[model samples]
Target: MSLTDNKSAGEELLLSRHSVRKYEPGVTIPEAELNEILELAASAPSSWNLQHWRFLVVTEQANKEKLLPIAYNQQQVVDASVVVIVLGDLQANEVAPKVYESATPQIRDMMLGQINGAYSNNPGLARDEAIRNGSLAAMQLMLAARAKGYDTVPMGGYNQAALIQELNIPDRYVPIMMLPIGKAQAPARATERLPLEDQVIRERF
Candidate 1:
């Protein structure tokens, strides 16, 4: 089959997804389904296969209450079936050997050498790569949720410091984004998009 045929459903899911702020009050996502969605999202690509993304799924009412203030009192923090805190591990390169455990010894050594060379003494590059990988994982999560008939909203309006303290997040893990997933309470309003001609370039900007 052609790419178009293979991607028709995926395209629909991507196009139909919107940031859902209001969710059904009593609905909860099944644990198994949540795990499956997370697995799919974790399959997103990472630099050197480091896979630095870490998800903190908050679903308990008490924990959600604690996160509410940290999230600037966003109702979705409590209303959604689950709120996933997507984090990036700044020290992900430390695990380069483990990440390439199944590879041939020579390949693993080469990967480790490359990772160490690129990341050691380069905090800025490591941080950038972590954020980029985490962002890809977050987008994959949102699309995966949509494929499961769930609505989601990616949030970045929280107080990062407060969230870290409240959640007892490790220092190495940087908070990248938050996603609230659940069934929508109401239909999402139509949104306008910039035309392809305005945003796309054939060769040069």
Candidate 2:
């Protein structure tokens, strides 16, 4: 079910989202609309207000075909209008100064100091924050696509090392996941979720 101008933002988009693995071939998403979806996804919150995600949009058919094998021969990778590779910036703290630039000098310096201290002292935490923040943006991206009447398949299965080498991804960024977005060839398969009683914790597990 495609969204319309009259349909307000609600369960229509959120509840309707499902992993769409098949897409109509050759359909194209205009750059302006694509940019809108991406900008909306970027509005997701991040640690220390430093957004840690980057996107690699693969729009050319030749490149998508090249990515197919690396994505385990997923046909959607070839047919989707675009394949967005979500990347996590491992050294996101480097942007703290800019993120807090509007603050007074004294406050900005204090924030920068705390950020540097934590990230520099704990490499593991830094890496965790990268993935954590990226995953948050990834979800928003998928939902944003749905709101735009597009489908998406959020994928984790891929040759990470090969993708990095093929894409020339920087060492400072971690490949988080791939999302193939396009017009669906068929409707997404229905999925069931665990009941709240079964999965939700009232307070603590």
Candidate 3:
């Protein structure tokens, strides 16, 4: 397809995506198919390509029940096929070797030095990178699921401390958001957005 055609297709996909909160209960997405979606999500860009994100997939009914209370009794937790806990890795630089495994030793070492230096100099940068890069993967994850005929909604209402404890999340990672994906029980709610002219920014505001 031509570039314009590709752009139209992209717009179509964006338009078709909407947050779905009511999923059909007991509708399971096969692990293999879900993995395909996850693989695509992992391709999202990261600072220094350290890939500072980890997915906690909650698929068992018992686990979902345990999560429901922490999420304020949101029914989507139990009804959705899977609830993904997107975690940001605060120690992403530790994976520098793996991220640049294909590069020459000298190049890899230099990149690792840069990654480690920036993070160590400013301790808060690790947290910021984790959240920012993890969020990019999360958005791609949602889009990939949608392209495969699944519905999802991004939720941030859960109790963070309880989630970490319940899921046994390690200290090195921070919980980013909870995303529930499955077949929707009903069509998603139609939404509107501000016009481009009103929302876009110009140079120097």
List model 1 lDDT by residue over 118-166, tens digit each: 9976769878988999999999999999999999999999999999998
Q: Score every model by TM-score.
A: 0.93, 0.94, 0.94
Candidate 3 regions with alpha-carbon error over 4 angstroms: 1-7
For model 2, the superposed segments whose C-alpha errors exceed 4 Å read 1-8
Query: What are the lDDT scores of the predictions, listed in order?
Result: 0.91, 0.93, 0.92
lDDT for 180 in candidate 3 is 94
Q: lDDT (0-100) at residue 23 of candidate 2?
A: 97
The residue-by-residue lDDT of candidate 2 on 1-205, one tens digit each, is 5434456667667877899988999999999999999999999999998899998999999999999899989899999999999999999999998999899999999999999999989859878999999999999999999999999989999999989998999999999999999999998888887876998788786
Candidate 3 C-alpha lDDT tens digits along 55-166: 9999999999999999999999999999999999999999998989999999998999998899889969999999999999999899999989998899999999999999
Leading candidate by lDDT: 2
In model 3, the clashing pairs are: none
